[model samples]
Target: MRETPSTPAPRPIVGMVGAGQLARMGWQAAISLDIGLVCLGSAGDAAARAGAPLMEGSGRDGAALARLAAGSQVLTFEHELVDLAALGRLEAQGVVARPSAAVLSLAADKLRQRRTLDTLTGVEVPAFTPVTSIGELEEFAAAHGWPLVLKARSGGYDGRGVWICDDGRAAGQAFAEAAAAGLELYAEQAIDLAGEAAVLVARSPSGEVAVYPAVSTYQRDGMCRWVTLPASLPDGLDKKIGRLARTLAEETQLEGLMAVELFLTREGGLLVNELALRTHNTGHIHTEAAVTSQFEQHLRAVLDLPLGLTSPVVPAAAMVNIVGPADGSDPATRLAAALAVPGAHVHLYGKGARPGRKLGHVTVCAQTSEEALALAQEAADRLEGNG
Candidate 1:
């Protein structure tokens, strides 16, 4: 009888901090690669609910971070709200973290990112100033005009920690609130936006990079509502955006993925809006539309594996977010009805429903952008009881 060989042990685990929907998606990707994905997140996080291998801890806790690093060959983040100093300490101890703390720090601070982008050629960011008091805000507004945008330098997302001050009185009120909260603040000139778009790029430590096509995004009350893949832009504009994204990835020496948001001005120019250093909401459509999804690409990049093709398999794709309905009904309650929509690919985040909260999303791919958008919108509306 021939001797039987035992199966080899599984590949090294990739630890992710923050087990939200992004980490949950990463978990799914890891399964395909036959690797482990251990999430360091609160017990109640979406990934935990989805039965991911969870470490059950706060990302800010150094001990918890060390515990996660101990069990994994490499560490990456699902969110940028991590404790960078702690991550640095882990690096010193020889724990590998892709998009190292130095790179992640730039994304964690808005002011730092703004300053860095302002120095790069062909990059245009809004006129901004770090404001320490109401006087500084008034001065900025005086120079840049009224209706200025105020943002916390850190810890802001999904329409929170941002204020629009139309006058000195409003600026003063916003400044006072920020000061009370002990938040660093900055004032920016509000641009006349024709629309918004984003580019997702993945880079490996060996410097191999892949960039996805730019996608048009629609925002409602500062939260993304939908995205149309292969954004309809004038000839040559998409190439320019793709180049900018590649330049950013190379300049940052990025490992893993970066999503660059841009504001398309009414004057036909693009301005850098924000930077996200992990899987982003705008790239959700890629899961169903692209030849290789962003989540999988990110894992490959972080592991220094060959990057996958970034082209879309379909002609057009649209993704519509399922924000909780005003009545606060769960999307799960209507899951069957949503699934009934032809060609609809629904993804529920396993989050409790609350007004304006993101519960899930729907993506539809078709031969035309209009058809994809219509189908995705209908499916999302039906899930939210709006259809």
Candidate 2:
């Protein structure tokens, strides 16, 4: 009699710290791959609302990180604000954390990231100086010129923790506010931008890498409003973006996905804006446009599995974020109208309405970038009751 075949090994579990919108989307990808994705966050988190399994814990707590690492083959993150000391301790215990604490540091602290990237040749980071006092802010401004931006060194996102100071008085006030809030701050030269763009890079433990197209991003009040891949760029910028992203993945020894935000200067030069060591708002367009979604690619990378193809299936794909209007109307109530837009793929995060909050997003694909973004914007307008 022939011997019985044994059952195949289960795929490695990815324990994500932070069960917000990023993990909620990642959970959907895990469902399709039939893999386990456990998230650490509050019971009322977005992944919780989506019905994914969750363990109540703080990502910055050493015990909590250890707990998440115990049952997980590899630990990952959906946010960059976790305590580096706690993660370092967890890693010392033989627990694997993809995009290790070192990589996470490159994202957690703006000052640190700026210094680190400046050391890399061909990577240009805007001139900046760590500011802990009004004197330092004024000094940097005097040197870098007026119209600088004051940024929190850590814990800033979606326009918060950022202040544009056109003169000395405004800079003083912003610095005082950040100081009163007990935030470490820095001042960076406000770049003159012809356009804004970003790239998504996935690098597996085996060193296999995949880079997505350089996608154009539009920001309002410092929050990304819309994004479109195949951004019209100066000759050879796209290819240059791919090479730079690949270099970042390899040089950093990344074992998971990273979103590299870039600034397209008015002089036709590229500057590294920021880095997110997890799924980013800009990469959400890949869910509808690429052969493989960014979430799935993230999982594959952290699991050390062969990466998925990232080629675009459509000529152009654009996404518009569903921001809560001033009236605070729930986008879900307008779902019918948004869905009625031809070729619009709408996703609503399970969250209540609040003015200026990101409640959901809409993606559309078309033969041209303009048409794709126009349709996506139209659908988003309907969702926001603007249309």
Best by TM-score: 1
Compose the digit string of candidate 1's lDDT tens values, residues 39-114.
9997789998999999989778889999999999899999888889999999998999988999999889999999
Q: Clashing residue pairs, candidate 1?
A: none
Off by over 4 Å in 2: 1-9
Per-model lDDT: 0.92, 0.92
Query: After superposition, which runs of candidate 1 have C-alpha atoms over 4 Å from their true positions?
Result: 1-5
Q: Relative to the unseen true structure, what is the Cα RMSD of model 2?
A: 2.2
How does model 1 score by TM-score? Answer: 0.98
CA shift of 86, model 1, Å: 1.4
Q: Residue 93 in candidate 2 has what lDDT? A: 80
The 10 consecutive residues of candidate 2 with the worst lDDT sum are: 6-15
Error of 2 at 223 (Å): 0.4
RMSD of each: 1.3, 2.2
